[model samples]
Target: MENHALKSWPDVAPKLVAVAAGRAPADTVLKGGAWVNVHTREVLENHDIAIAEGRFAYCGPDASHCIGPDTQVIDCAGQYMIPGLCDAHMHIESGMLTPAEFARAVAPHGTTSMFTDPHEIANVMGLEGVRLMHDEALLQPINIFTQMPSCAPSAPGLETTGFEITPDDVAEAMTWPGIIGLGEMMNFPGVVNADPKMLAEIAATQRAGKAVGGHYASPDLGPAFHAYAAGGPADDHEGTCEADAIARTRQGMRHMMRLGSAWYDVETQITAVTEKGLDPRNFILCTDDCHSGTLVNDGHMNRVVRHAIECGCDPLIALQMATINTATHFGLERELGSISPGRRADVILTSDLGTLPIHRVIARGVTVAIEGEMKVDCPHLDWPAHARDTVHMGRALSGADFEIAAPAGANHVTANVIGVVENQAPTKALKAELKVQDGLVPGDPEQDVCQIALVERHQATGGVVNAFVSGFGYTGQMAMASTVAHDSHHMIVVGTSHADMALAANRLQEVGGGVTIWKDGKELALVELPIAGLMSDAPATEVAAKADKMVQAMEACGCTLNNAYMQHSLLALVVIPELRISDLGLVDVRTFELTPLFDEGQDQ
Candidate 1:
């Protein structure tokens, strides 16, 4: 079915005029409700909201004149009316679902707007994939704006990708109906260094007067960070601390504190406004990378707002951050931020503001979700079959393929290990002494060190780089493999046993790249993400249930890191600090240099 439900006020205004003048029918009038004014942080009681032509025509203490012979009126019983929640920065692909499925998952959560970046898909399927996401997003029941993917490879020479995004692509996407801005500028180093390509993309977004999203993952508050700020990114969601939030706001960039499925960064950073008392207007709430499990089971933007309230923020202030602050940041304040005139009539009804439970959701003056269930039809996109068969390893891999032969005559060695930082995307550059057994480096469960490998799948290049990682609390013979590796879409397999690791990695390749878990050489769970190796066409419920099993498998393997799968995916990500693995070799993010897996006479 086609989705043509604009619910614009133009069609409803004339009827409201008649109701005001006693001539025609009024659609619906909500009376005796408390207007939770986010702009003033006050609640005005006993107000009546007049609806006509699918818009809120008049809102006051009394709209008796708006009542017509055929008018339908409902007494709200003094329920508080709040604006619909808005997500400032996110990637639908991060939900591991297509735009249609992502919408289906979040629509019930009173989330009406989303600024999504499709770079995850672009890295694997290129421009066509990005356009597919953009088009499908616009067809949803609510506003789903697209930020043209800015960085496909993420780091130009650091890692390889199935496809690359060019400057020309950025310029043309700005003309698309759903295009809102450029995706996160992950090339922060390049921007600071005046890279011509990065500059060109920024210029195109600037020329269109649209927002330029940011991803300055570095904690450096020095000249390098300053130079990146000067490069035209208007907002950032990578900040993890109060200082990171303050630094961005001080430099005229919106500080987006996000609370996603795993990245619980809001509490640490929201202190900039809640305690340090920076202006809350410059802070925005978002879900940087929400998985479908979180979206379907928990709320999206609404969850972020509730998290902010729990983080010592005033409920009203948090709502403003989630709504008006987000709208103003994207230059859409006048259109969607509040209940002001000419704005889209997207509002929510709840009994309390602090524990914001959405009893009803009205978007564009149409009841979309009632009691946390979608009441309207959310259209789906006709996804092509090619998106379901993307995994292409030239051939099946064996246990021998995963074996990392020790250097000639090397028995013991110290190796560079990628340290997993719980609840954060960044890794640590660590040196660990490892034991070499039978000419092969092995992990020490006592040391919490495990083997990490990146198998290059972009060009079918038979390249695999092996490294080490800590902080998983892993204590068994198990492995996990996923194609959801961030930025660079390679397959990263991590395990204590090379046999299980090889089995898990080969399982994904056997069924097309997705996520897989192996325990003592047995397949435990799998999610086939064939769409650019990042998303599945399965329903959110189905995917979340499967992902739950994967999470359970991780737990069964004695892994105890928070959201260990998310930490695993960053194994091949070269942007974040301190150590990472690519198809080439282990990288020291701090020094950007290649490091060996072992040092002489040290078990690493």
Candidate 2:
């Protein structure tokens, strides 16, 4: 396979010098544009850029001398020539599409580079799965740097995964050409407490001279947060508030504010820069998770930049946050982030900075997209058959399997419930009084309380851990089951009716793995993510269309939360607070312990 990584400066310097000195003709030249200089934070007007061997050779007020008779010259028409946008942290599998398809979807949005963590797949298929994603990422026309998954189970003992990522895996991944750093170290407690395993993984990445991603999900800004920062993570994207962003940057870690499909964190966190006057260089922009529908209908990093601008941030500063700041965080500023002479020729043409409309996108000196349409073909990986057949339910489920038996003669109970917070990752731990019916506790749709179960699919244990969840606003007899449960990759079923929940769970098992919605014992919508139950090899547009239908189906079921599907997927993520469910049991994330569903004495 051809190494798609940009050639080193040493290897391309001679050619670049020849082109700049007019000793050789440039391959392409973008003339008469306004260069958005990220390094100095200024827009130099009437500039021209000359490219040679997929790297910029000359970027100045004029590059007429570098142009030759055979050089391809494109007039920018005074458009704002900004560095191609980069997502500091994201997951390709979150889009429900493989790396190639995700690239195809986002390239049109002027996202030329992405630093993706394939931990979602790693939880299901282990090191081999990560390799598959990394290999495919290297084949894309744009830059897709893979991060070695640092936490597969995410929280040890709090959850169980199909495969666990070890320190050896981190060491091995560091040698891969496409690996940029270690994926988000989700185990904040492990780092803070100096757990040998977490420290060893961080050591491996640091020894290899790569960035270590961070995920300090706790809201506490106490000693624990400081200890986590001292654990050697260079950047973090889990900050949700201004204080979180300030603390992260103050500790010399880049605070990556995200604006994904459901994560609306940029507006709140960017205040560290907009209001507090913190240096903008320490703040980056990213999309921690975006579904296929969002990629197709909305934008990628472009959307994040626009959102930051809309949140009372300067256009130049927002552009820097999405571009140079991100590249600098990952140690690729010289190679890909800027429009400098030695950097990869990744540039985007926009008429306005605030209301950015990507008219043209150039990556590695190639016009990959034009007018919100892809101009280049993104190559795909030939996935093996085993990757598609991952769901193992042991046997079909039934209504009885979902029944939550009441404790002896208990008529009512104060149940611990998982509350869904819209446009955020963290959930709320709530308590509700529920009544028993026929020796079983039943969901009350009128109170907006429903049954949530974690069906263990990885080991085919047939173990169903039942709990309660509110805030979805789901009514009637409906259930939604997804194999894309975060961290554990187990099947999560939520519904008011046990029969519909059974139907939904069984449907996903029958189709290998994906998301399925059932209402009144009939299937409503399905998005078949057959690849490790986390992603599909289908085109982004097709997957997005199905995902759109799935969202509509959620709405039809009376779910009023924004991006309820995202909320559903994260129900099993034990890393984030304040409550969650896993294959093990109901998790009180604030305490990082498994708690019983019912409060003591409430079952009387």
Candidate 3:
């Protein structure tokens, strides 16, 4: 892997001083551009930037003195030389592509720096999986920093993962190259409650002088929320409302507003700066989870910045949220994230700020992308066979595996349902009364109720926890199954028909691991994610094309929720409220405890 660590400034200090004094020729001089000075939060016109050894040596009114016979000068007429964007918090696995491919997909959108949490892969393959993601990230041409996963099972006792991440794992990862900090501490309750293991992980990262990421999914802003902020998480991205943002910033935590494939959080949280006039420096922008289709079509950090501006934020302020604010939060302000002297020459030449268009992208003094296309290669890692073959079903699933037997002598029962909220992470805890047929509880499409099953893929326990779910508006005889279930990475199958559900679950096992949709007892669409069943080694466009088909297939089945697949993938995430499914049973995330499937009720 390439070493992306910064060179000692002292080693290049003499050369940089000489360039600034016009005594030495700079390697590249970008002239006649308006420099977006993130430090001063202003745009200076007709500025020139001199670069040497892939670092900016000068950014001022003119670089004529720094230019020599061998100097390469690029004209940036009518362009805003903005610092390259950064995503402060994200997961590379969420893109359903390897780090190389995810970088390829987002580079055209001017994302020069990324802080990725590989916890999703960590849940499946443990520390080795994190190393694979870290190694691959180093091979990319941009600043892709890794955050050692802190929570794999995310919430212990509430869920079970293929592999568990220990405190020793977090401490060991802190010593690896390119590791920025600890990943999101999703067990906010654990931190607030002062769990020894959670605090140890946070202490390890802090002792190493690295940022400790936060994930406070609960809405409680009482003593517990305050305790969590006091527990050492430097920044948080799980804020969903304006109050949440205010509470975070007020407590000295960076409020990271996100706009991902389905997480519509920025519009609500950005009001902290735009409406309530909070300090913009304490706010940041990020995409917590973005699928391939969103990366290929909608945009990445660029999309989030645009949405922030639309929410009444100043264009410069939004850029700071995406760039300098993120860099400063990670203690990387001097290394990257701004068009300043001694910083990496990662910049984007754009014509507008609000409707940002990536006309040219420069990373490490090299033009890596131009006009919505990549101009360089993103190197790949040779994934081991174990990473490709992760799906393990002890036995083939049958229609009977999905059957939910009704309680004896009961004709109707109120079942706890995992309600899918549109474009949000939190689901509604719902109860639906259903009539029992043939000693079984059949899914009621008329009530928007369907069956959801968590098929244990790890250890091949052959444990299938059956429950009910509402929403998705699924009408036809269809079923959807994915091995990418959150936290545990189990196989989650949901449908109205047991037979089709069986077909979908078995098909993913056949493909090693991937998502499959079955209708009328036939496979309608499939995306083969043979790599850890969470991501595909295929090109982003290929994976995105298949994902597009999956979305269309969901729509064809009479489901009209935005990014339904994302909601489906997160159904097993036991950390997020209010309800979820796991190998144990239906979990009321609000209580962080397993609950009975059927509520107490009398038979009709």
Q: Best-fitting candidate, measured by lDDT?
A: 2
The sequence of per-residue lDDT tens digits that candidate 3 reaches over residues 64-125 is 99999999999987999999999999999999999999999999899999999999999899
Off by over 4 Å in 1: 1-3, 7-25, 69-72, 599-604
lDDT of 2 by residue, 396-438 (tens): 9999989998888799988899989999999999988999989
TM-score of 2: 0.99
User: What TM-score would every model get versus the actual structure?
Assistant: 0.95, 0.99, 0.99
Which pairs in model 2 have colliding backbones?
none
| Global local distance difference test of model 2 | 0.92
Worst 10 residues of 2 by lDDT: 1-10
* RMSD values, in order shown: 2.2, 1.0, 1.1
Per-residue lDDT tens digits for candidate 1, residues 146-264, read 99999978887777788899999999999887889999999888899999999999999999999999999899999988999999999999988889999999999999988888799
Question: What's model 1's overall lDDT?
Answer: 0.83
For residue 322, model 1's alpha carbon misses the true position, in angstroms, by 0.6
Give the range where candidate 3 is weakest over 10 consecutive residues by summed lDDT. 1-10
Best-to-worst ranking by TM-score: 2, 3, 1
Q: Order candidates by lDDT, high to low.
A: 2, 3, 1
